[model samples]
Target: MRGLLKLTLTQMKLYLREPVATFFTIFFAPLMLLLFGAIYGNEPSPLFGGRGSMDVSVPSYIGLIIVTVGLIGLPIGTASAREHGVLRRFRATPLHPLAYIVSDIINYLLMTVLGVLLLFLTGKLVFNVRFEGHLLSVLGGFLLGTLAFFALGYLVAGLAPTARTAQTVGMVLAYPMMFLSGATIPWEILPKGIKAFAQYIPLTYVVRLMRGLWFGDAWSQYGTEVAALVGCLLVGGIVAAWTFRWE
Candidate 1:
């Protein structure tokens, strides 16, 4: 426990010391949210039998970015750390190495809250957008989504050999994931085949579940989304654990 704590603290310290990385990580998603919200948020909810639309899309959009940029981007950073021998040195230390990764997860969680709040507050203060869903419900979906994406990130970190490769691969993977998962484009606007295909992607389920929470959609509304999140976390975790290497 002490070892884990030290490692986690070290990880947090690294993030704290590097203000640029933290700034962009914490700021980029919400910036994207704000931009999108400014553009599309003014329009009506165009799909899913939604009511005369207002700014309801704000929270869901924030939640979606939180899962993507924050959670999915983590592995790319870890892969860079691996290439730089950060992970290798940690393995040699008395510190619990997994705890280091857990620390990254924790920091991302904190950032998620900040990002979501920023988006929500920005929309409310600037655009009069309000939410119907409980914060806890959306937060619950957000955490679940984070876990799933973190698992995917670990897999990328474990598999990608070089920092360059990690960056390239991460971009390649993240772009499609974001698009298909309904973050870049809403699933409601997508075709049937695309939505069907999205059903298999872990991030898709996460975004849907999150939207459900934000919209005050019934608990039974997104069962498949929740299931996919759990499944991805489990499978991706196993793959990452099996594939991870010090170098």
Candidate 2:
């Protein structure tokens, strides 16, 4: 346990040192919120069913943060480490292999939580974003969505032959999902064709589930979204476990 904690802290420090990862995971969403909040001004809108723009935006941006870390950060970091023989070197260490993997997971998860907290703090302090849902429910939904995407990220790292390939694929998959999943733009304001297309994107489920929970809806109301995210988690995790390589 002590070894795992040390590894996790080390991994976190490395991640923090990466400029792209730090900016996207920790600062990007909050910056977007500030930019849009300034433009939209968080007025209660009929489009969002009387919720302020910031109220709806804050939760949706959580999905954006998840994708940024899970799709871009995790895959690129894991694959780069593999390409650089970092994982192979870890195998020679006294600690168990599982410790390395667990530490990576812990590092990413803690970073994600920190990013979310910063986002919420920014919203609350600047825009006064309202939170109607119970904190536990929102937390549950957040974890589910995060894990589902993290599994997909691992799958990408496992399948890509090189760090460059993983980065390419992750960016390709992430950019479209960001725009179409209602993570960057509000779903209600999107065109009908775009909305129809977004239903097929996995990130859309995360956005929908998060927004619904944030609006104080019961879990029962998001049965489909929950099921879809669960399916993603299971399928991605199984495939990633099979395909993952240490070197």
Candidate 3:
């Protein structure tokens, strides 16, 4: 446990030292909130079911964090480490390989949580964003969505032959989701054709699950979303495990 903790801390420090990672994962959502909040002013909008724009945006932005960390951060970091023989070196250590994987997971999860908190703080402090859901329910959805994405990230890391390939693939998959999944823009405002396309995107489920929970919808109301995410988690985990390599 001590070794795992140290590894997690070290991984976190390394992550923070990467300016692009820190900026996008930690600060980007909050900056988006400020920008949109300034433009929309959190006014109760008929388009957003009469909720303030910031109210809906804050929860949706949680998906943004997940996408950035899970798709962009994890795949690139893991692949780069493998490319540089970092994972190979860890194999020589006494600690199990699972220790390295777990530590990286912990590092990414912690960063995701911090990013979410910063988003909430920005919304609440600047726009007084309202949250109507049960905290536990929102938390459950958050964890489920995060794990689903993390699994996909690991799958990407395991499959890509090189760090450059992983970066290219991750961005290819992640950027479209950011726009289409309603993580960057509200689903209600999307074009009809875009909304139809977005339904096929996995991150759309995360956004729907999060936004519904944040609006105080019961868990039972989100059966489709939950099932989709669970499917993603199971399939991604199994495939990533099979394909994963130390170097």
Candidate 4:
């Protein structure tokens, strides 16, 4: 337990020390919100199911943070550590490989939570967007979605031979998920074929579940979404564990 705690703290420190990571963690969502919110303003729009654009934008941005950290940040960081021989060196130590990966998961989860909170608060204060729905329900869906994406991250990290490869692969995977999953583009306004395709995307389920939970949809209303996320979490976790290497 103590070893895990120490490793988690060390991971957090190392990640935060990177300038790009720090900037994105702190400002990415807010900047995106500010840019769009300023243009769109805070009027109730039929485009966003009658809620203000910021309302949908806030939850979608949170989902983006989750996917971005899990897919892009984690894979690149883990692959870089492997390229630098950090994971290899740790193989000879008392620390188990699971502990190392778990620490990374914990560190990134915290960072994602921080980013979500910041975005939510900023939306409320600046854009006058109010959080709807049950808080606990929203958190449950968010955490489940986080785990699903994190497991996918582990899979990418395990497969990529170098940080650059991870970055390339991560971008290819993450961008599609981001754009089609309603993280950047509203799922409602998407074409019928695109929406049909999105139904198969795991991130689509996550974004829908999150938006529903955030904005007054019943927890029971998102059973399919929740089930899809859980399925991805299990499948991705198994693949990641099977493929994982110390170096």
Candidate 5:
């Protein structure tokens, strides 16, 4: 337990020390929100059932932030560590493998939660957006979404042979999902074919679930999205665990 705590803190500190990671993980989402919100300024939209654009934009950016960390940050960090033999050195120690992986994951998750809070606060304070639903339900949806993406991150990290390859793979996966999964563009405004394609993407489910929870959409109506995210969590988690390598 002590070792896990130490590793978690160390991983967190390492992430904080990286300027790019610190900026994207902590600032980018809120900055994006501020930029778009300034242009759109709490305008009610028929696309989101007349809620302010910031409301939809804020939650979507939350998903984008998580995807950024999971799909790009984790994979690059893991592959770099592996390529540099950090994982091998850890294996030579007395610590269990789970401790190392869990610590890193938890560190990323904490950063994600912090990012979400910052984005939400910025949306509320600057754009006058408000959550119309229960806070706990929103939190539940966030946790589920985070877990699903974290598993995907682990899968990517486990499979990539080097940091460069991991980054290339992560970008290939991340960019399309960011644009098409309703993270940046409103899904209702997307073309029919694009919407159809988005239905198959895991990030789409996450964004929908988060948006629904934020707007007080009944949890009963979200069974399919919840199920899909849970399935991704299970499949990705198992594959990542099975494929993980020390060297």
Candidate 6:
């Protein structure tokens, strides 16, 4: 247990060591959210109904922004480490294998908190957005979304053939996720086929669930979205645990 803590911290510090990569991981997703929010941030959402348009969409966008960092950033970073022999080296150490994943998870949780707060603050200052939902529910959405996505990252890392391959895959998937998750293109605006395509993407509903929390929305409002997130986590978690390798 103690060793895992140390390993987790080590991976985190290493992540910080690459200043550019670190910055991209921490700020890029949020910046994209802000840019998109600024462009369409003022509009109403069709999915989240009954309230005004602006009221429902902001939080889901915020959640989408944060999840990208964890879901997208973690896999790329881990893949880089594995390619560079970091994971291979770690396996020879006495520490637990879980340490590798746990560390990335911890780093992302911190990133999630910071990203959400910073983006929210910026939204309030620049975009005039504010948190309106139940605090506990907002928190629940973030936690569950984080866990589900964290598992997704690990699963990606576990499946990649090499670190270089992981980076390529992460890059390929990132835009698809952002687009389908309703970051760049709002889900409602997409065609039926595109919307059907998005249903398979994990980040979409995770954002929906988080945004729902922020709006103080009822759970019933999120049936399809929550169900999708749960399904992704279950299937992805199994694949990650089964396929994850140290080297």
Question: Model-by-model lDDT, in order?
Answer: 0.69, 0.93, 0.94, 0.87, 0.89, 0.70
Quote each prediction's TM-score: 0.83, 0.98, 0.98, 0.95, 0.97, 0.82
* Residue 189 lDDT in candidate 4: 84
Clashes of each: 0, 0, 0, 0, 0, 1
TM-score of 6: 0.82
Between 2 and 6, whose lDDT is larger? 2
TM-score of 1: 0.83
Which residue pairs of candidate 3 clash? none
Point out where model 1 deviates above 4 Å: 1-10, 16-24, 41-56, 70-72
Residue range 105-192, candidate 5, lDDT tens digits: 8999999988888998898889888788899999999999999998998888888877898899998999999999999887878899
Instruction: List model 2 lDDT by residue over 1-247, tens digit each.
Output: 9999888998999889988889999999999999999899999999999989999999999999999999999999999999999899888879887788788888999899989999999999999999988999999999999999999999999999999999999999999999999999999988999888888799999999999998889999999999999999999999999999999
Please list the residue runs of candidate 2 whose C-alpha ends up more than 4 Å from where it truly belongs after superposition: none
Per-residue lDDT tens digits for candidate 6, residues 120-169, read: 66666766755668888788777777787777777888898877666667
Give the least accurate 10-residue stretch of model 3, judged by summed lDDT: 92-101
Tens-digit per-residue lDDT, 1-247, candidate 1: 7766665666667665766656655666557666775566655554645542335456446546655554445766777778888778878877665676677677666656666677677777766765778877877778888777778777777787777776777677777877787765766677998887777776667767876787787768887888887888899899989988778
Q: Stretches of candidate 4 above 4 Å error?
A: none
Query: Judged by lDDT relative to the true structure, which candidate is superior, 1 or 5?
Result: 5
RMSD, model 4, all Cα superposed? 1.4
Over 4 Å off, model 3: none
lDDT of 4 by residue, 1-247 (tens): 8999998888888888988986676679888999999998879998877898888999988888988898989899888888898889988989877787778888999999989988988899999896888889899989999999999988898888778998899889999998899988888888999998888888888889889889878978888988888888898899989888777
